[model samples]
Structures are given as C-alpha cells and as structure tokens.
Target chain A: MIRHSLREALLSLWRNRFMNLVASFTIAVSLLVLGLFLLLAHNLRSVVAAVGSQVTVSVYLRGDATEEQRDRLMDSLRGRAEIEGTEYLSPQAALEKFQRLFPTMREVAGELEENPLPASVEIRIAEGHRDPDSLRQLAEEMKRLPGVDDADFDLPWVTRLRDMVAMARAAGVSLGGVVGLAAILTIASVIRMTIYARQQEIEIMRLVGATRTYIAAPFLLESSLLGILGGVLSLGALYAIHRHLAASQGGLVPVLRDLLTTSFLPRSTSTLLLLLGLAAGALGGLLSLRKISL
Target chain B: MVELYHVNKDYGRGNHALVDVNMAIEKGDFVFLTGASGAGKTTLLRLLFREEIATSGKILVDGMNVSTLSAFRVPTLRRRLGIVFQDFKLLSRRTVFENVAMVMEVTGVPRRQQRVKTYTVLEMLGLNHRVRSYPLELSGGEQQRVAIARALVNEPALLLADEPTGNLDPNLSWDIMTLFKTINIRGTTVLVATHDKDLITRMGKKVLTLDCGRLITH
Candidate 1:
C-alpha cells in the first residue's frame, strides 16, 4: 500500500507536468540566489583573513642611534609580549633589495651615495594583537625607544581594512539571512499550493479511513524529493557560477576555491534542506487536516 | 450488531440533525434505514461509521463505543465496516481492478490474496470483463457495482450502504440488493440507508423509519 501511494503520487505529479515544472523551477531559482550569496560571503571572508595575516608595523631608526642602539631598540620591541618577532632591514640591505627588485632603482640609489633609506625594524605582532587599538598602543610603546626616529605604523589603513572586512561580513550575513528566509518561504508557499490542489483528494482519503500518517506520507516524500533535488542542483549551480566568476576575476578573488567554496551542499546542509522540505509538506498536510474529521 | 442510545447529533444550537434517536440491530441481521429528504438517514449511517461523533449520548457498533473512539482508532474501527457511498467514490483515475484491490490492500491483505480476492469478487459481480475499465468509462450502474465489490472485498463484519440503488434501474437495483442479501446471509450484518419505500417494502427487511430526525415508526 505504501508503494501504491508512492506510485500514485509520482504518477499524479507526472500527469500534472506543468504544475511540477513550476514548483521545481521556483525552488531551484530561490536556492540559486541563496547559493550565490553564500559563495560570495565565503570567498570574501577568506580573502580578508589572508590579508589580515600579512600586515606588519615598520618602526624606523633614530638619527643619532648607532648600530648598538638600533640592536637594543629591536631587542626591546621583541621583548614585548605582543611582538612576535622583528626583522632588521639595514640601509644597505634595503638598498640591495630595491636594486634587485627594480634594476633602474640601482642608478637612483647610487645617486644618493649615502643610501638615504632608513634602517627600519619590521615588527610582526602576535595574532592576538592584530586589532587596530592594540597595534596603535604597541606602536606608541615602541616610539618611546632610545633609537627610534619615529614609529611609522600603517595603523589607519589596517583599521580601515578591518572595518571593511567587518562590513563585508555583516553584509554577507545579512544577505544570507534574507535569502535563506525567502527560500524557506518559497518552499512553504509551493508546498501549500500542492496541498491545496489535492485538498479534495485528501478529504476523500480521510473519509475512507486513511490514517493521518498514511495521508501525509506521500506528500512529505514528494516535497522532500523536490527540496533535495533543488538543494543538489543549487550546489551544482553555485559551483558552476563560482568557477565562471573565478576564471573571470581570479586576480581579485583568489579565495574563490577556498574550503567553503560552492560544491555539493555539505552533507549536513543538504540533509537539513531535505528535512525542511518534509517539514513544509507536513505542515501543509496538518493545516489542511486540522478541521477535517476522519 | 449496532445500538444507538438516545443518539442526539446537533450541528448547532437550533439545528438538530438527529434528535434522541434510539435503535438497535442484532448480529447477522439485515436492516434498512428509511426516511425522506432531510430525514437524517445519512446522518444515522455516518454515526455508525464514526464519520461524525454524536453531540450527546452513545453509539455502539459491534460492542464498541463508536462515539468515544479517538481519531487514531477510527480507521481500525472502519476496517471492520464496509461503506458503499451513493456516488460510488471510486478513484476516477484507477481501473475497476485497482478500485476493488485497494480495499483489501488497505486492510493489509497480502498481495497474492488481494489479487485472488479482487478477481473473485469482480467475477462474482459480473465485472470480470471490465476490470481494466476506469470508473469514467463505466456506466452508472456498473460503477455502483464496482463500489459494492470494493466494499465487500474485505469481507467486512458490517456493511453500511447509502442509497446503493439510487443511480440504478429497477432491475439493476434488484440485482444489487440480491447480492447484498447473499452477503448478509453469510453473516455480515448490513444496514442500508435509502428513501426507496417501494424497494424497502418489497424486500421486507426490518425497516427503521425516521421523520424530522426522530424515529417515527419501525
């Protein structure tokens, strides 16, 4: 009998080809938009995190500071708990790197025979001190050192970048929340229509002594199948869209293929979609049955 | 067996569909519930099938208080009762064979037994040749016959048929009633709700008469 009910459901769906098409298409489109936002949020988060890891504060040497004074200043900065490690870029080493990076800069360097480039210490802060307020306080402490000419910390840009990342995150979360709500509502509406279309049939089934579960099982299976199929198709669509965008803009969005890339809906997420579809269908069934007597 | 103790089914404050109706039928007995339009004939049948709970008092079917049966247990109660509706209620998309087989299938009869029983019942009803025909393809009388076949396929302990012959010719009505009589003789208690006084009087079964939702005579 269960098989018969399933067969009946599928056959009916097949017979109503137009309705089935409409329902599936609505589900697919809603999921696609949702997937697109999810992919965007995932890639943006990766890029921001990568950029945040690479920024460091550079503190230049004092004019009267000797080599020993510079060494002491470096040690003092390194001794601080927030400073991870320090790299000393002497004037000569800085000039050599510039010469190698831009051969044309060698002639420019020779013109300034004294090698005007200042000896700077590149201070790498522990990740815990990556926040703007902490970096500013650390730079102030280092500026008080004996040999430090003036501490030059790219503090403002770091703060701006953090704010931008935060804004992106908020935007992503908000977009996801809105689209997810729309997707769920779309599923609910379509399932409701499906139930309404079969209201008469359900009434007859109840009158004929079918149990609540018996009357509801087939509809639940039908809606869940649609949702699972939509979720899978959304995963594939998101991946395809991600691949297309990555090929077009790989330079800007290098993290397009990160851990959270649009691939198959994670097993847990797809399972959730399936359950949500079933729940939507079950809710419709229950509402339709509320006043009906068996 | 069936018993209704002061069965009062009121739809609302002022509208009474059945009022203080008391009745009883013994095991293995056949009865006709007779009344005119708005006479609560269908209401009485609905009460027996547990389709509508009585507003007050109790209805017992086969020693079970049908009025107290929960929605979950209604199907179990219905499994022992066969009901033939006036409109046949055959699924329009299904063939006659499927319509008959559904009843047995719902009752959890094994597939092989369902096939055997359905075919035998169809053959008995002279519908073997039309088993593959959909309800829409069959005549009114033939559809009613299929409905009867479905109702009897499970060999229900009690049969409640509502206007079984309303859509049939006199000859077909007699034929269908004769089939009901045979099934009743085989120990299936039958209660038929109908307005055809001529047919009920001719059949001479114990008739319970109703007027304005009250038992007028018996």
Candidate 2:
C-alpha cells in the first residue's frame, strides 16, 4: 500500500503536468531571489570584517618634536589598554614605504632633495576599541599629545560599511521570510486545485471506506516533490548565476563577484533550504486537507 | 446484526431527516428499506454506514455504536460494511480489474491475492471478459455489477446499498437483486434502500416502510 500510494502520487504529478509546472516555477523563482540576497549579505559581512581588521589610527609627529618627546609618546600609547601595538616609522622609512606602495609616486618624491614626509606612529587598537566612535575618541586624545601634528585614521567609511552590512543582513532575513510564505501559499493553492479536480474520485473513495490519509498521502507526496524539485533547481540556478559572475571580468559583475568568492550558500544552508521547501510543500497540502472529511 | 433505538437524525433548524426510527436485523438477513421520495430510507442506511451521525438516539451495528464511533474507528467499522450506490460510483479512470482490486487494497491484501480475488469476483459477475475496460466503456448494468463486485470483494459482514436499482430497468433490477440474494445466502447481511414497489412485492422479503421520516410499517 505504501508503494501503491507513492506510485499513485507520482502518476498524479505526471497527470497534472501543467499545474505542477506552474507550482514548481513559482517556488524556484522565489527561492532564487532569496538565495541571491543571502549571498549578497554573506559577502558584505566579510567586507566589514576585512575592512575593520585593516584600518588604524596614524598619529603624525611634528618635525620639531625631540627624540625624548617621541619616546615618551610611544611609551604612553603602549601603556594604554586599548592600544594593542604600535609601529614608529622615521621620515626616511616613511618615504621608503611610500615609494614601495605606489611606484608612480616614487618619481615625484625623488625630485625633492629632503624626503619631505612626516614621521608618524601607526597604532593598532584592541578589538574592543575598533569601532569608529572609539577610534575617533582615541584620536582626539592623541591629537592633544606634545609634538603631534595630526591624528587621523580611515574610520568613518569602514564603520559605515559595517552598518550597511548589518542592515543588508536584516533585510535579507525579512525578504527570505516573505518569499518563503509566498512559496507556501502557492503550493497550497495548487494543491487545493488538485483536490477540487479529483473531488468526484475522492467522494467515491470515501464512500468505499477509504481513510482520509489514504486519499491525502498521494497529494502530500506530489506537492513535496514539487517543492523539493524547485528548491534544487533554485540552487542550481544560483550556482550558475554566480559562476557567470565569477568568470566574467567586465562591468559590475567583477565587483559583485568579489563578494561571492566564498562560493554559493554553505552546504548546511543549502540543505536547510531544501528541507524548508519540502516542509512547505507538506504544510501546504495539510492546510488544504484540513477542509476535507475522512 | 444491526440495532437502532430512537434514532433521530436532524439535518438542521429542527428539520428531522429521520424521526424516532427503530429497527434491527439479524446476521445473514436480507431486508428491504422501502419508502417514497424524501422518506429518509437513504438517510437510514447512511446512518448504518456511519456516513451521518444521529442528532439524538443510539445505533449499534455488531455491538459498536454507529452514532458515537470515534473518527479514527469509522474506517474499521466501514470495512465490515459493504456499500453500493445507484450511479455505480466506479472510478472512470481505472479499469474494471483495478477498480475491483482497489477495495482490497484498503485492507492491505497482498497484490497477487488481490488480483486473484478481483479476477474471480469479476468472473462471477460475468465481467471477466471486460476486465481491462474502463467504467465509461461499460453499460449501466455492467457498471452496477462492478460496483457490486467491489462491495463484495472484502466479504463485508453487512452490505448497505442505497437505491441500488433506482437507475436500472425491471429486468436489470431483478438481475442485480438476484445477485444480492446470492450474497445474502453466503452470510453477508444485505439492507437495500429502494422504492421499487413491484420488486419489493415480488421479492416478498421483510420490508421496513418509512413515511415522512417516520417508520410507517415494519
């Protein structure tokens, strides 16, 4: 009987080819959009961590500051709990670093006799003090230090990037939830139509003493297959779209592909989405079956 | 055996479909439920099959209260009761062989035995040659026979047939009734609901007559 019901379900899916197609297509499209947003959010989070890790506060020294004053400032920074480490680059070292980072800038710097670059102390803040507000406060305190010409770091933009990543993630969650609901509703509507189409046959089955489960099992299996198949196809479509983005080098695709370098959704996330699809299908079928009597 | 005590089934708004109906039938008995249109004969059989619960009253079939059987237990009760309808109610998409086999499917019978039993029943009903034919291809009498075959395949203890011959001519009606008699002799109690007075008189069976939802005579 189990085999019979499964066979009946498969046969019914084939028999109602058009409706099944429509249902599957709707699920696929919805899941695909959800996957795209998730991928983007996942990538933006990576950007926030990467940018956060690379930024620091550079406290440039005045040319008139004595060696003793520079040494005192370095000791003060090292004693602070929020300052993880520091690197002091002399004027010559700073000019050498500049020449190495930008080859084109070396010609302009070489034309000047006195390597006119300020000696600066680059401070690496502790993880707890990495946010823009904390870095700005620390920079303000360092600016008042003796012989400090300027204290600055590329803080605002990285902080903005972190905020944007968080907002995008929240939006992704809402979008995924809305799309999942739409998929469930679509499956339920299609299953309801199937129930109506077989109303006469179902009535006869009930008359003959067939249990409600006996009649409902096949519909559940059919809808479940529809949803799972759609989920798998969405996964494949997302993969293909990412591959295209990764392979091409022109236009905005390259910028987008940089974020997607971690690959499609993680294996666990993929499995979860597939399971969610199957559950949605089963739930949809049961919702409609509730209206029927055994 | 079947028993009913003060069985009153109200459709709604105080309109009773069956009013104070009382009846009983022993095992292996053949009884006719006779009444005019709107007489509640169908409602009475439906109650026996547990299709509709009584608004007030008690009904016991083989010691199980038909009116109060739990939802899950209804299928168990129905398995022991064969039911037929005037329209034949055969699944048009299935062949005669599958249609008959489907009844046995619900009982979880082995497929091989299901095939054997279905073929035997079809052969007995003179449908062996049309085993592969769909219901739409069969005549009304043949379809009715298939319905009877399906009802009998499970060898139910009781058969509740509602208006079994309402859609047939006199000769076809008598033919189907003869099949019922044969089933009854085999120890399956048969309760048929119909208004065919000619056949009712011809068969000379115990007839329970209903008038306006009330038992006029038994």
**Winner by TM-score:** 2
Residue-level lDDT of model 2, residues B1-218, one tens digit each, is 99999999888997889999988899989999999999998889888888889989999997788888988788888888889998888899899998889887876789899999999889888999999999999888999999999998988999989999989989999999999999998899999999999998999899999999999887
Per-residue lDDT tens digits for candidate 1, residues A1-294, read 679568756765676657555555555555566555445545555555666666678888865679888877766765677777889898888789889999976787788858787888888877677887887777787788887877756656656755655665566456544654555455456556666777766655665567777776666566555555556665667668666654564444455454244344446654554454344344434443444432
How does chain B of model 2 score on TM-score? 0.98
Model 1, position B17: C-alpha lDDT score: 93
Task: Please tell me which predicted candidate would have the highest DockQ against the true structure.
Answer: 2
lDDT of 2 at A211: 84
Off by over 4 Å in 2: A55-155, A249-254, A260-262
> At residue A175, what lDDT does model 2 achieve?
77
Model 2 Cα lDDT, one tens digit per residue, A1-294: 578679988988898889888787777777777777778877887777777777789999999989998998998887787887899999999999999999998899999988788999999877778987889898998899999999998877877877777776677667777877787788888888888988988887776678878888888888899889888888889889888878777757565667765666788878877886778778777877888664
Q: How do all models score by TM-score?
A: 0.81, 0.85
Residues forming the 10-long window of minimal summed lDDT in candidate 1 chain B: B100-109
* Residue-level lDDT tens digits of model 1 in B1-218: 89989999899968899999988899999999998889999998998888788999889998788999987898888888888988888888779998888766666679999899999999988999999999999988899999888888878889999999988889889888998999998899999999998899889999999999999886
